[model samples]
Target: MYSQSHFVKALELLILLVVYLAYGSSYRSSSLYLYVTISIWFLVFCWLFAPFVFNPSCFEWHKTVDDWIDWWKWMGNRGGIDLAPEQSWEAWWMSEHEHLKNATIHSLLLEFILSLRFLIYQYGIVYHLHVVHGNKSFMVYALSWLVIAIARVTKGCFIGEREVCHEASNCVPHPQGHRLSCPHRFTVPSVRCF
Candidate 1:
């Protein structure tokens, strides 16, 4: 049986998928760009939902590393104390695994919020450029693609940072004090509106 949280998350994703599909179909003409964008967005939506739908208990833990080039074994360790019963090695792993899974679910939700904004920019900007104004100039196409690429890349970075912040803030030592460990204001997608 799915928990209430899982239901809520699935419902939210379903709503988004419906909205994107409806908008894509109703929008002017069957433009390849619009459909492709929606398809990609839909895949993202599915990716977010797959964990909850398929195997809620088996999500692999992933930590965000700040330094890619100067990586170390410590880079993967978040320094969080796992309080699970010390029965065996498997127990220890499972304890940390569960913590990571919960954190990932929360971070994924935040990312979904940002993805919504990106969806708006993706469909709205593309529609306006490719269809509404009827300006099929190469410059317009290039600009649309550019904005779309930026939004996608920036969204990934924001989500990764959030996951890192989530792990750090929950660490036993509370790395670098609360202010330093807690996620930045950017995690809140509403702030991006400004």
Candidate 2:
């Protein structure tokens, strides 16, 4: 009874799951292996079960508005009128739900696989830059890694917060402007670039 689209989706999911399992089991330590297994399971659940199990209809509507508002807000909140087109709640509701369901699956493969790949590359870079180099080069390379790591961590945290707000429906409306509502608020105030 599976349609072509369904078969394609299922095949993609199976392939990703196999790859993750292979990578996960290559770890030697029991604790690390267990952690990896749990992490993968949690990610799969989030990408598969979350859409249906956690208020599919509402989540979809919320996500649609969230995306539109986020884009509108990014454009200095100037085109408010253009962004205010009335949408059919029911149609929006169904579309949002379907979008969320697909997003969950897509994100699982994209985010988890890419994050793992990046981490591997980062570790290799750090090893080559510090461990393989002598004095001067080591210090320079280590500092570069430190700066990049800090930037990545800071960006990741802010993105996480914004995602939480998108899911929770309690995003604060800034009086100054939409740009003012940027996730930079979650980051340290002292680090402003000006």
Each prediction's Cα RMSD?
Answer: 16.1, 15.2
Report the number of backbone clashes for model 2.
0
Q: How accurate is candidate 1 locally (lDDT)?
A: 0.52
* Candidate 2, lDDT over the whole model: 0.52
- Worst 10-residue lDDT window for candidate 2 reads 77-86
Pairs in steric clash, model 1: none
Please, what is the whole-model Cα lDDT of each candidate in the order they appear?
A: 0.52, 0.52
Cα error, candidate 2, residue 160 (Å): 25
Per-residue alpha-carbon lDDT of candidate 1 for residues 1-194, written as tens digits (9 for 90 to 100): 23234554556556655555656456546687577766766665665676556764444343223323224433344333443333333344445456546577778787678668656755655564345477657676678779778887787664454455545544222343333323343222111311
**Model 2 misses residue 184 by how many Å?**
31
**How many clashing pairs per prediction, in order?**
0, 0
